[model samples]
Target: MLIYLLKRLLMTILVIAVTSVIAFLLVHLSGDPAAAMAGEGASPADIASVRETFGFDRPIVFQYLEWVGRILSGELGRSYYLRMDVSDILADHLPVTATLGVMALSFALLLSIPLGVAAALRPNTVIDRVALWLAVAGQALPSFLFALGLMYLFGVYLRVLPISGGTTWAHFIMPSVALGYYATPAIMRLTRSGMMDVLQSDHVRTARAYGLSSWRVVIRHGLRHAIVPVVSLAAVQLGFMLGGSIIIESIFSLKGIGYLAWESIQRADIEVIQAILLVIATAYAVLTLLADLLNAALDPRIRIS
Candidate 1:
């Protein structure tokens, strides 16, 4: 187990290193950061001064090494637009993003699990068909469009929810629903399939033969077994949620890292961009690791192997 963990940790480190290099290079390749910051009307000397200040004058390799070194030394650099430390900006924004992610995940789980289990319990029935159709619709619709529709129906037409901005729990309802609804299909499908398989298992058959209550057989025996796969799906979805937040946050005008990243990109704020990507990659890597650990814990065969 220790060796497996160490191996995964090493792999995660390598992935982060590779991701950092790719992110840095991609941003640089898109345009000269210094030139972008200096603007079009700037004179030659102005460009040169800006380049020197930002160390864009250095060789790419040296620039990367310097950036990495500064990162190691706890300097994420200042945003070109905000003229403030990227770390400070991230510190302020992370809580909002985290809170939003947690709420959205909660909403997704609450919406998916019961519906999926019910579908599995009575396959080919009206309830199951309706759930499946809803799942299909969720999978088909894009999150931004879904959000807009919700805004129109709940916010504009009914005036029951705010269309944009985060001020209260009501403000979170639309965007969280948008994000959660988009993710529900995957969870629902995974749970339904897993539950069906678990229901047909020998253990479940034995439990039924032993006169266990239907709900007990389903919850105690089948639900427990189904959870492993559901958890794996949940972890993957959680990581995706972090990445997908950019669109939802932008649509809702939420004060989160995703919003910050979007604003940073508009101003060519490389520091914030790099910081956001690095943080998000790290989060994904960690979530994967946690999922592996959970899998091992749930299935002893994994630990044995």
Candidate 2:
């Protein structure tokens, strides 16, 4: 198990390294940081001054290496566009997105698990059909459009929830619902399938033959093995939530990392953009490794493999 964990950690580090390199190069090459920082209708001298101030005139490789070294040493550097510390900016906004993600994930699991279990328990029944329709609709609808409809129904007309600005718990409801429902389809389908397969396994039959009650066999024995794949898929879905939060955050005006990314893109803030990309990429790598570790812990076969 230790060996497997170490290997996974190494792979995660390598992936993050490659991602950082690509993000650095892409951000630098995408647009003129100097011009963006200088604002519209800036003179050539103003642009040159801005470039000089931000070290834009330096070789790209040198700048990238320097930035990487600083990042490794726990420095996010100052934002050229915002004229503030990049780390400070992220610190202020990261929690909002992080909280939203956690809430959304929780909502998804709460809804999907029961629906999936029900569908698996009574396949081809009304409950199963309802679950199938939900899964299909959740996947087919765009999150933003879904969010707008929710906002109108719940926020505008019903006045039960806030339409935007994730300040209070009420404000968080719609965004979390919109984001969480987007992930629900995949989870529900996978869970139902996993449960069905687990139930048909020899172990399940043996447990049933041993006089174990149906509920006990299904809950204690069946769900244990069935949840393994669900766990892995959930981790990936979480990464998607983090990445997809950009649109949701914008619609809701939440001061989260996703909203920060949107702002940085509009202004072409290279420093902020690069830092955000690196942060998100590292999160993806770490979460995937965590999923692998969790799977190995739950099922020893994974570690051996």
Candidate 3:
């Protein structure tokens, strides 16, 4: 297990290294950062001043190495538009997105796992049909539309939840539901299928033959094996949530990294854009590594493989 973990960690570091290069080059490849930073109608002198000031006049490789050095030193550079330290901006906003991602994943797991287990236990019955229908609907529905519906229902009609801002937990409820619902279908389907396969395994049948209660057999023997894949999926989904929350954050007026990304793009803040991409990519790689370790813990076969 230790060896397996080390391999996964090394792979994650390599992935992050590749991602950093891509993030650094992406803005440079688009066009002159100095021109974007200087804005329209700027004179040639202004552009030159901007370029030289930010070291954009340096070789691309030199710039990249310097950027990496700053990142390693916990400096994310200054935003082209905001003129503030990128790291400071991220520190202020990262927690909101992180919290939202965690809440969204938690909601997905809490709702999907039970539904999947129930559906597996009662195949072809009404409970199974309802769960399947929900899964289908979740996948088919657009998240933005779902978010709007949630806002209208709870915020407008019921007036129980706030429609915007991230000041309180109530502000996150609709956004979390909207964001989490997109992931629910895949998780539910995987869980149901895994449970169905596990329930039919010889070990599960032997556990039943030992006169264990149905719930005990299902929860203990069945779910233990069935949930391995779900752990992997959850990690991937969480990374997606953290990176993909821009639209949700914008709609809900939440001050998170997602909203910050949107603002950076509109303003062509290259430094912030690069930082956001690198941060999100690093997060994704780290989550995947953790997932691999968790899967190895859950299923010894994975470590052996």
Candidate 4:
């Protein structure tokens, strides 16, 4: 297990390095950063000065090495537009995103698990059909559109929730619902499939033959076995939620990393954009690693590798 964990950690490091390099290069590939900063009206000397100051005049490799070194030493650089430390900006906004994600994920699990289990218990029935339709719709709709419709129904017409912004629990309603609903389809499908498979397994039949109560057989045998896959699915979905929050956050005007990313992109703030990409990528990597570790813990066969 220790060796397995060490190997995963090493792999995580390599993945992060690759992600950082890709993100950095992709941002540069679009055009000259200095030219973008200068906009359409800047003189030749202005562009040259901006280039020299930002080290655009240096070799790409040198710039990459220097940026990596600074990042390693806890310097994320200043936001080109805000003129503030990137770290400080992220620090202020991280909690809001994290909190919103937690709320959304919790709601998704709460909604999906029960619906999935019910669907599995009565396959091909009305409940199962309903669950299937929900899963399909949830997967099909874009989160931002869902957010807008929710805001209209629940916030504008009903006046039960806020239309935009995430200030309190009330403010979290629309955004969280949109995020949770988007995530539910994948989780529900996984849970339903896992549970259905477990229900048909020989072990379940053996438990039933032993005259165990149906609920007892399900709770003890079916749920435990089915949960392993569900947990893994949930983890991957949670990681996706972090990235998908950008659209939802933008619609709601929430002050999260997603909102920050949107703002940075509009202004072409390279430092903020780079830092946000690195942060989001690192988050996804860490969450995926955590999921892998959890999967290993849940399945002994996995830990052996």
Candidate 5:
């Protein structure tokens, strides 16, 4: 287990390093950062001065190295537009996004699991067909469209929940449901398939033959084993949640990292952009690693494979 963890950790670091390099090159290649910082109507001399001050005057390799050193030293650099430390900006906003992501996933599980289990238990029945149709619709609809529909029904018409804002629990309901519903179809399908497979297994039959109640046999002997894949998918879905937050946050006025990243891009704030890319990529790598570790822990054969 220790060796497996170490290997995963090393792989995570390598992936981050490679991502950093690619992000750095792409940012530089996009256009002149200093020119973007200077804004419209700035003279060429002003842009040159800005470039020199920001070290864009140096070779790209040296600039990347310096940026990496600052990261290692915990200096995330300043946002040219915000006039604030990049770290400070992230500190203020990441929690909102993280909370939204977790809440969204939780809402997704709360929805998909029961529906999935019901579908599996009564395959070819009305409940199963309804669940399948819902899954199909969820996968077919875009998240933004779903969010708009949710806002109209729940917030605009029903007035049961707030459409936007992250101030309270009520504020969270609509956005989480909208953002999470996009991933629900995949989760529901996985759970349904896994449950069906487990239900057909010998242990389940043995439990049934022993006169265990249908619910008990399904929940104890079937769902428990089926839940392992769900756990793994949850980690991957977290990455999806974070990445998808950019659009969702925009719709809901969520002042989170996703919105921050969008703001940084409009301003061509390379410092903030670089920081965001690294942080998000690192997050992806870490989540993937955690999923791998969890799978290995749950079933040791994962490590062997």
Candidate 6:
């Protein structure tokens, strides 16, 4: 187990390293950060001064090495547009995005797992069809559109929930639902398929023949085995939610990392954009590693594989 964990950790570190390089290069490739930082009306001298002050005139390799070194030294650089520490900006907004991601993932799992179990248990019945229809609709519907509908129904029409802001739990409900629903169909279908396969196994039949209660057999034995894949899927989905919350955050005025990314892009805040990309990529790699560890723990066979 320790060896497996070490291997996964190494892989994650490599992924983050690669992602950092890509993030840095991509931002640089977009345009001259120094030029962008200088106002359009500024003369060439101003751009050169900005470039020299920021070390942008240095070799790209040296700049990348210095950036990585600073990152290792717990510095994320200063934001060109905001005139604030990049790390401070992220710290202010990361919690909101993390909270939203957790809420969204929890909502997705809570809703999808039950529906998947029900659909699997009663395949081809009305219950199953309804669940399938819901899965389809979830996949087909755009999250922004769903967010709008939710805002109208709950915020505008019913006036029960707040339309925007991350100040309260109530404010996150619509955004969470809308962001999470898109992931529901994939999780639900995986659960349904996994459960169906598990149910058809000889162990399940033996458990049934042993006269165990149906629910107990299903939950204890069936779900325990079937949920291995779902755990992995949930981790990936959570990472995605964290990275992809820009649209939902924009719609609902939630000040999260995603919103910060949007703001940085508009202003060409290269440092912030690069930091955000690296952070998100690191998050994704870490989540995948956690999922692998969890799956290994749940099924020892995973450790061998």
Candidate 5: tens digits of C-alpha lDDT, residues 198-254: 999999999999999988998988987888889879888988787658889989988
Q: After aligning candidate 1 to the native by TM-score, how far in Å is the CA of 114 from where it should be?
A: 1.5
Residue 268 in candidate 4 has what lDDT? 83
lDDT of 4 by residue, 1-305 (tens): 99899989998888899999998998888788998888889999999999998899998989999999999999999987788999999998888888788889999999999899999999999999999999999989887788888988998898988877767877887788888898898888888999999999999999999999999999888887788878777777776777668888888888998888888887889998899889878887788789788878777888885
Colliding pairs, model 4:
none
Tens digits of per-residue lDDT for model 3 on 32-121? 889888899999999999999889999999999998998899888898677799989999899999989999999999999999999999
lDDT of each: 0.86, 0.89, 0.92, 0.87, 0.89, 0.93
What is candidate 3's CA lDDT for residue 51? 93
- What lDDT score is found at residue 267 in candidate 3? 88
Model 6 lowest lDDT segment of ten: 296-305
Predicted structure 3, TM vs. truth: 0.97
Model 5 regions more than 4 Å off? 206-216, 303-305
Model 6 has an lDDT value of: 0.93
Which 10 consecutive positions of candidate 5 have the poorest summed lDDT? 296-305
Alpha-carbon lDDT of model 4: 0.87
Residue 77, candidate 2: Cα error in Å is 1.3
Winning candidate number (lDDT)? 6
Candidate 5 CA-lDDT value:
0.89
Give stretches of model 1 more than 4 Å off.
none
Please identify model 6 stretches exceeding 4 Å from their true place: none
Q: Give the TM-score of candidate 5.
A: 0.92
Clashing pairs in 5: none
